[model samples]
Target: MELLQSADLYRRAADRIPGGVHSNTRARAPHPIYFERADGAFLYDADGNRYLDFVLGNGAIILGHGHPKVQAAVQAVLSQGLTTGSETRLGVEAAERLLQQVPTAEMVRFANSGTEAVMHALELARSATGRTRVAKAEGAYHGWDSAMYVSAWPDLAKAGSADAPAPVLTHQGADAEISRRTLVLPFNDVAATRRLIEEHAQELAAVVVEPVMMDIGYIEATREYIDELRALTSRYGIVFIFDELLTGFRVAPGGAQEYYGVTPDLSTFGKAIANGYPVAAVAGRREFMEQARPGGPCAWVGTFNAHAVSMAAMCATLQTFEGGGVWRTLQERMSYLEERFAQRAAERGVQVTLRGRGGNFHWYFTDADVRDYRSAATSSAERYRKFAENAAARGIWLAAGTLSHHSLTIQHEEDHLDAFVGCL
Candidate 1:
């Protein structure tokens, strides 16, 4: 657990990388452990230390690491050729598979990441509707883009009032114009969202949101809340968009849209789509997506869009999910973990809370149920952080923060859950 080699690697990486890691999420306390390799539900650090990986690459590794099918697919594609700019048979297969699986995706276009996909979907909505303003749910992490980056992790002072939250720029270079063009609304507040949309109906282009708010403790939207948005958007002629970057293939094969029984005009998908590969997709009605008109004004083009290797991996991964009963097994595992955590907390005279369903969820060291971002913010960050550090030390790896989700790769074994809960 000392992880000497990991410490050395981090020290060297810090000298060159901005945070000693490529992404902020990976740069947690005690230095980010340098991973040597991963296979099936476990990760080996630079010190050769093994861990039962609940993080599962932040819910992207649905079937676990080094999945034979995905690995073989990538290797087969690489053995022949690896290129991003050219159209290939694997790309066609990936798109067909995605369109078949995703509920609202009649046609699909590819991008490099969730940020790009979300940006493209927003632009498409605006172009189709001829509107400029876009509304996004508060505390959602679409990506590091200007449109959705506003109010991602706002500080306490400038976060504004809870009901009508002001969009605070997390980065320095963000221009004031982006905030002016964007409207921020609280999640799960169906009435508030309806009022906001009606107020901005004429100028609004789209209402983009995550069906399941994973970044803030995996909070789920009520059925009434989802129905309200869908009805309002349709009545107002506003585009509805579900940003399923995190929940795409993790929650259900058809994504949250299918699970929640709500349909959006447009949707953006990523993360587990390509099994952690740097790939994402924007899909929707033909008319809506036509704004990116092949010969028209708006253009959503990228060099690495639907790269061969990523396509192969995605196709292979999707095939695996459809053929195998992965989600069923995952649902059962999460249920057991939730019950065990609750029992352990009660026994220890400590209060622990669990939220979300199926493969993704959050564990909080509080008695109250967290319904939204504001509610989640009041939880014991100090205790959760300490628990994460201890869990990682005890050969269990999870998302390194107070708020995060569980991947389906977690062990369903009773003793493992008992040991984990008892440890706390």
Candidate 2:
């Protein structure tokens, strides 16, 4: 597939924009493929080449690009106007729908992005517990905020021990004090996590985890591990936070909590919640969430918190999920694609393991069962990059990087899967 127009645009963009792309992830090795339009499961590039999109806006497009329901809702909201800076009926309805869907969401507050939701959640956690330190699993990305931006993808040589990982800063100028207050733990290791929690129980304000670690390719915590963490945090009076920004509303209606039968003290949700709308939320027990303004210690205020258009989009997105069989169809499609990809890899004598559940998955170019960040870090980055580039050349758009997970949507059909496998 030729991307001459995309190349020309990228060159012009580089002269003005810092990296030739708004997001660093969109800048591929050679040049990014610029999409003119997207519909269903396909992206039409500036050069007029149609490619199957497995990236799906990094797992945000659950119902797929431009779903009729979401579009109609957004259009209706647009007719009314945008960003009133006051509470709207649509916002209340959206909150009610969220409370009905998520098991842990007794109260909800909206934010503009997942990063903001996570920051608010952490602040609430600290205020509620009156503690200074926060604990997070290595290779788990809560957000790019200073408090949680440590050890997301630390170099193995400097990441300390497998059981107790060191807090390595992910970016320059990350707050040294915040990094000092953050504790890094290994995912899916029950005993190690328990020990770390106990050791830092007094100072630890919260324990944040991605139910499925998307940064490390959707590696999920074992059932026993998740259960034990829940129990331990409860016993120690630490705020247990599930960062479901990637997993929520995608794995199930109530997200990984419902799917795994483990409810957290608090949860942060985004990505697929609004099916591509720029909205995120922090939900938890009323006692904890009430701390967000009007009545409590934590200050959670955003001008665009529950923008009318996003609220309408969210309500419509939830309506689609409520219509039944949505998740079932997505699961079946994902399973079929996984099986076909594995078969093709085996036939080609390639050593790779596909990990994850429901509509999300990762292809690691290794045979090992990836359970934790340490184990997952060993996958071949160069080989995965080359594979993504080659697949893109053949009209299959995988996630740009090795650590990222590719996702399927309700828009993805058998033909897209066949085209992907044919490329393989």
Candidate 3:
């Protein structure tokens, strides 16, 4: 239970880095565990302890750590040099495979991160619609840019009515123009969303959302809500964007749009597509995607955009996902885990609910149905934090964030899962 090496490394890191960790999500209370390496579904920390990795690189390592296919693809491209600042065959294959899988995406462009993908998607929406404002779900984590950084995890005290929630900015002191332009809509409320969209129809260029709000718990948008958004956006000529950063390939082969049978003008993807490779994409219908062309209204240029190595890795991951069995397998395994957790919680007389789709999941401390951000937030944060702490003590590395959801890799076998349950 001693994180001696991890503690020492963190002490040094804190001297140089603002936080001992790179990502804000990794800024755990005492210290973040620094892992030496990961193999399959196990993470070996600097303290030399092996733990079943439920974090799954924040849902990015769908095939698991050090997947042979992805590793081989990456290795194959290393000899060809990293970035040529020109096009290559691997890049073409990656884009073609993405468009083929996502039927709604007639064309696609690549980026290095989910945040950049979301930013570019919104810019494309604005250029195509010639509008200034955009609307997003109240608690969804689209990105961290000024425009998309509002209302992700706002204090309920300041958040306005459920009918028309205010856009609460994440940063304290900053320009307020971004907040003023961003509109917040109550997630999972079709009537309220419709009213806001209609009222601001002319000025609203885009309506961005996560089909499943995985950050706050695996809270899903009702089918009726999605249907309503599509209808409203179509009527108003507003660009609809699905920010599938966490849910893209994990939720289904195509994503939430494919799973729900809904279509959006644009969608952003990252995480699972490349199986841990640093690559993200903005995909959508030709009318919208074409705006990013050479002299078009939207600009799209990047030195490492679809660098050959990452594209090669993405192509291999997509090839593995070509057969429909991966999705089915992920669903079956997660459902089994949910069943076990439910039985265990019942035996302990604990009120809880497990929610997920694809392979992502979360267990709330409350038994009531968690259909949206507010209900999910009401779950016992203290209990969840304690559970994560206990799980870490028992050699199961769950995410340290209070409301963060967890996901398993495809490589996690029955024995690994049973060990998790045994620890619980």
Candidate 4:
């Protein structure tokens, strides 16, 4: 309950680290708690208080924290060296494993982070299609790439219209000029998206979206929307890019594309793909992927792109997923958690609007069903902040906002599930 040690550490951390964290999102308040270690579904803080972690490294650790398979794989490559300038069989095997699971990907190349994956994917789209403009969903989180970052969690005030969104940068010092190259689309709006895509079909290089959106409170794409979007992009010779950084492997073995029975032209994979390791991938059909090869279209250059350790971790995680047991368990556990969440909300007479499938979820603190940023913006952030503060006191670490999404791991045992319901 007491974060006294963490409070003191934050004071020191704030003086040195910008915002007391490496990534701005780690600044989880009411005061950031420093972690000493993590195992299974629990995190041991600097103050030695153990918390049932629902964040799970922002939905990357699908196999759970410090998982034995991932650990041993990482450790095996540790003695082999951190990274080699050239290629490894492990990297080749990792991509093979990924392609086996994902039906959309005929070929793939590794990267270090989700942003890098998205950036390269966008570049491929532009180069392959010979178009300059890109389109993305209004509320989706596709990492922090300048072109893709537009309209991701934009302030509604500046976010123009719900049906036809204007590009609003999520960060300061973001290239204002990039806004001219980026276009925004509404979530779950098949008609509006079709209209916009057709309107800019000539200039549109790609339509980047998340099948299961996480940043805007986990809004999912309707089947109709996804199917129509794919058709529209194909009709116009534009690339259909799915940013599955948070959804890949976790939503299903083949990800949202497999889950929704849709295939995209190109997609970015990370997060759960490495089970918390620093690895990502841009994968697609042969023609598009080959463009990154040699003398094709785009330039592919990154010294540490295929770190052996991370690739091994990815291989181990994906191999484990190949058995298909973990995904079934994830569905069962997520369903139970949803039931408990709703039960407790009903008990307290709280009006909670929930949206989730598989392991990803969020409980919007409002009565309205939310589909996009404009509708989701109505949720009460203030109430969620207080709830987060109280949950932290009781050894539960929820993500900072009501609208922010969280995930479950296979490691969350019955006790963890019960405690989660109790916290609710």
lDDT of each: 0.81, 0.86, 0.87, 0.85
> How good is model 4 by TM-score?
0.96
Give the CA lDDT, 0 to 100, for residue 197 in model 3. Answer: 90
In candidate 4, what are the lDDT values of residues 129-187, reduced to their tens digit? Answer: 89888998887778777888788777888878778988888777667788647889988
lDDT of 2 by residue, 70-178 (tens): 9999999999876659999999999999988895678998998988998999999989989978999998888888889999888888888888888988888789789
Give TM-scores for every candidate, taking all chains together and pairing residue i with residue i.
0.95, 0.97, 0.97, 0.96
Error of 2 at 240 (Å): 0.3
Range of the 10 consecutive residues with the lowest summed lDDT in candidate 1? 410-419
| Model 3 pairs in collision | none
Best by TM-score: 3
Per-residue CA lDDT of model 3 for 1-424, tens digit only, reads 7889989999999989889878877777688788899999989989899988998888898888999989998988997776658888888999999998898889999999999999999899989988979999888887777888898888888888978998888786535797768989999888888888989999999999899899887988889999999999999999999999988977888899988899899999998999988999999999999999999878899999898888998999999898877788788888888888788878888887777877899888886678877788788988887787778777898887667888877788777767666544
lDDT of 1 by residue, 1-424 (tens): 6779988998899989988999888986778889989987778998899887777777777777888888999999999966779889998999999998885778998888888999899898888889988888878778876778887756658877877888877787766687657888888887777888888899989888888999777888888888998998899998999999887866676888888878899999887777677788998888888888688757877889889889999999888778437777777777887887777777877777875565777877766667677777777988888787778668888886677776655334556565566557
Clashes of each: 0, 0, 0, 0
Which rank order by lDDT, best down to worst? 3, 2, 4, 1
Greater-TM-score candidate between 1 and 2: 2
Which pairs of residues clash in candidate 1, taking residues 3 or more apart in a chain or in different chains?
none
Candidate 1 to native Cα RMSD, angstroms: 1.8
Sort by TM-score, best first: what order? Answer: 3, 2, 4, 1
